[model samples]
Target: MVRIREDDINEIRNKAGIVDIISRYLPVYRKGKSYTALCPFHDDHTPSLSISEDKQIYKCFVCGAGGNVFSFVQNYEKITFPEAVVKVASLIDYPLDYEADDVREKIDPHKETLYRILEDTIKYSMYELNNTEAKKQYLEGRGLDERVRQRFEIGYNPPNDALYRFLKAKGYTD
Candidate 1:
């Protein structure tokens, strides 16, 4: 769970322009000064998606899927309202210092456990890739090409007790 400040939310909202943000999801055409696009939420031959640059709002005339930046992220990504807010904040480079309580209250307890488990698994996998001789052979035997490995930034960790020391320096513990 992570906390988000109200100021961060507002900064995200302001920086995330409606036309630019929505353009990534849908093709928009200029109709006078406003832009119009086919609504992604519904099937429509005529373009009904209208966006106002001044207001930073979008609305689909065919359907009622309309709101500010936060609503757009929430509906499109199918994430929680706070998650959407955080994503937007990150996209806009807004600094956030939220209390854990705020984020914990919003996140599902079951999902939180799963998320933590996945995070730990990734850490373990990365550690094994770097430190284990058998794992390195396995990757090589699997025909893992250098191009692919470089593309993914894969590297073998030296056979030393350095990862634990590194994690400790970073203030992480198992």
Candidate 2:
């Protein structure tokens, strides 16, 4: 997965017409450079949801539900930011590639340490299974391929206390 570039995001913003997208959920009427629809986030008799196609943003002016296209979809669909981006991109027939490396780099140090410990544990488990013919045969008989195993980070944990000892030796505590 690759991160969505800044230029690509701008393209999404420009291509996903605010009037067109909002009309899909509610009846929108053109009012000069903007559009208005009934506020879906709150009960209202008059149209209060204002959408600016020029600004690529929406505002309720009633319940204060407002933001750009991405945020509007996020609130309307009750989905995450990335999901909203994908939804908007799909609406405009735009392609997107997702990457988690940036998010991982921003996580707390303690969480990063836990991730490292789990990675080391997986390596240790794989090493421990190197000589276990029975386990290998079991996995193979189950129709698992080497590529699938590697992709899923599958590893064998011995029936004994080897995994615990390995973690202990690596300075991991319960």
Candidate 3:
């Protein structure tokens, strides 16, 4: 599950036009301000795919399949969402720097369990910090604001067996 930044996704969408991308796959004819092409999604069509260059979207009136540039590539190429994003970016020659600021080291196969446990622990701590007002106040008092906490990946460990219970429920052993 590679998490791409929303900003990068928007930028790519803005840069890549719906008409340009769809035209690469099929022959589209100008119909007023919009374009029309035979809907590849279904059989025997007379230009049912209505592509709006202004809206940057496409709709197959027969099949009811419609979406943006990324979705068009995704469906057309039969690729995953992330792969479609990369494909769209490549098509427009847009450089995609989607990796997070935190440079995580690659985990060894042997240490996979440990890595999962660490990730679970982080999630549990984050939940605790969010739910516990006292914990939030303590962090705020110590000058750890929301932005600072988010930047540092700060979290709180509640004074209870919550973590133990959470790990147990997740099937992580001691």
Candidate 4:
């Protein structure tokens, strides 16, 4: 996953017009002060998607689909948020690539090892949680479903030396 700076995203949002981008996907027409288009998100006989150029936003009254340009592109194109940002930047001819400072160069070298250790521990804990029925039951009792667990990488580390053994196996020094 590539990281896009917030400034670049905001710049694309500011430069691109909501109506223009939406119009590229579907027909947009002048309706009073705002623009109107048939909701592409849902089956519709009339124009229900209201696009406000003043506010730089769009909203579908019937299905409640709404957002700014990046979100609109994301939802409509079924692409990731970063992909949508890249697409929008391309649409308006905004340069997306910029040299970013190397963060690793400034951080303590030991920090990377610590991060790896923590990451490995998390992975081992997640494996334990999946294999342990009691842990799964406890998560369910707390209303944490599989979806939430997977989303948050929720895991458990048993009160044992398993984690230490796992780390040692991965060649981590004490």
Candidate 5:
């Protein structure tokens, strides 16, 4: 994923209304020029969290927890700062793009072959669970029914260790 730019973060913050964003997490009541709600960060009998409509900032008088909408989400939701920024950015429909690189290297062809072998192992294991006599008892013993095995794509490796020889025959070197 692309990192959000500072300008884009600021623009998203400005576009997203503090009241709308805060209301999603907690209930807010309009009190004259600002909105009030119970402080989420600390225990309190009375509503001490105040949101400034003009400044686009919120403050809790009881806990002294205060910041912009992004900070509030980060604190209340226990999410990362960047996550908060991305959440707010998505709310306001901010455009972000990742830098792409196209480069190829010729090395370790066996790595790709190993990956293919592992994939084939998984596929064969699943087939064994359904069709083979030895695998049927093993699957039942493990409580791995058809549904469970299908869900996880569980399979077994060949007993003869044929995978290595198969890859070698297919022009793969370790």
Candidate 6:
């Protein structure tokens, strides 16, 4: 599901006038800050689709197809809500920031190369820390238990370029 901020919606609504937008799709005649046009959603000869510049909405007296500009685009273009939103935003040149849902799987079994690389790095660090008694004692002295060290991803490093070598072996650069 895609979600747009209310501020973006309001901005789109304010910038993209319903009178102007409906006029592009169909002929609209203004009468005292409001416009009326033929209801495009239904077969009607009489102009029943009432558009309001003040309310920023449209209402059909006969067919009752009423909503804001987004709904207008949605019904007119025959597109999804997100697609209509994109179209309306494009009309006003509004920027949209997209984000993924917070539902990441625990772990993917068929791990990719990048995932494997990160896992291998963690395992190597764990191995380095596991085999060293001095480093363990130092960490213990610093009030960090095994669980705490593991939680914060604390690693043990030898005197040389172990991490550099690890990355190099994994086909990584810089």
Which candidate gets the maximum lDDT versus the true structure? Answer: 4
**lDDT values, one for every candidate:** 0.75, 0.82, 0.87, 0.90, 0.80, 0.83
Lowest summed-lDDT stretch of 10 residues in model 5?
96-105
Report the candidate with higher TM-score, 2 versus 5. Answer: 5
How well does each candidate superpose onto the true structure, as a TM-score? 0.55, 0.52, 0.55, 0.56, 0.54, 0.53
Which regions of candidate 6 fall more than 4 Å away from where they truly are?
A: 99-174
**Per-residue alpha-carbon lDDT of model 3 for 1-174, expressed as tens digits?**
546878888899999988988889999899998999998888835999999998888998889999999999999899878778888888999989765335567768769988888889998888889888988998899999999988877888878898999999999777
Over 71-168, each residue of candidate 5 has an lDDT whose tens digit, in order, gives: 99999889877778877767667774422123235658777777877776676567655667778678778898778878889766567856566657
- lDDT of predicted model 3: 0.87
Per-residue lDDT tens digits for candidate 1, residues 1-174, read 555677777877888887877777778898998988888778878999888888889899878889887888788889878888887776666676666664355678778766765555456556667666777778788887556665675765556766556555555556
Q: Write model 4 residue lDDT over 1-174, tens digit each, in one string.
A: 547899998889999999999999999999999999999899988999999999999999999999999889999999979889988989989999843344325767699899999888888888999999998998999999999998998889889898998899999999
Would you give me the overall lDDT of model 6?
Answer: 0.83
Instruction: Compose the digit string of candidate 2's lDDT tens values, residues 1-174.
Output: 336678877788878888888787788988887789998889978999899887788999989999988888888899877778888989888877767564556668788889988899899877766668888778888987677777877789878898888888888878
Worst 10 residues of 1 by lDDT: 117-126
- As for TM-score, the candidate ahead, 1 or 5, is 1
Candidate 5: residue pairs that collide: 125-155, 125-156, 126-155
RMSD of each: 7.3, 8.7, 14.1, 11.6, 7.4, 15.1
**Number of backbone-clashing residue pairs for each candidate, in the order shown:** 2, 0, 0, 0, 3, 0
Which 10-residue window of candidate 6 scores lowest in summed lDDT? 97-106
Which pairs clash in the backbone of model 4? none
Query: Which stretches in model 4 have alpha-carbon errors above 4 Å?
Result: 98-174
Measure candidate 3: CA RMSD: 14.1
Q: Which runs of model 3 end up more than 4 angstroms from their true locations?
A: 99-174
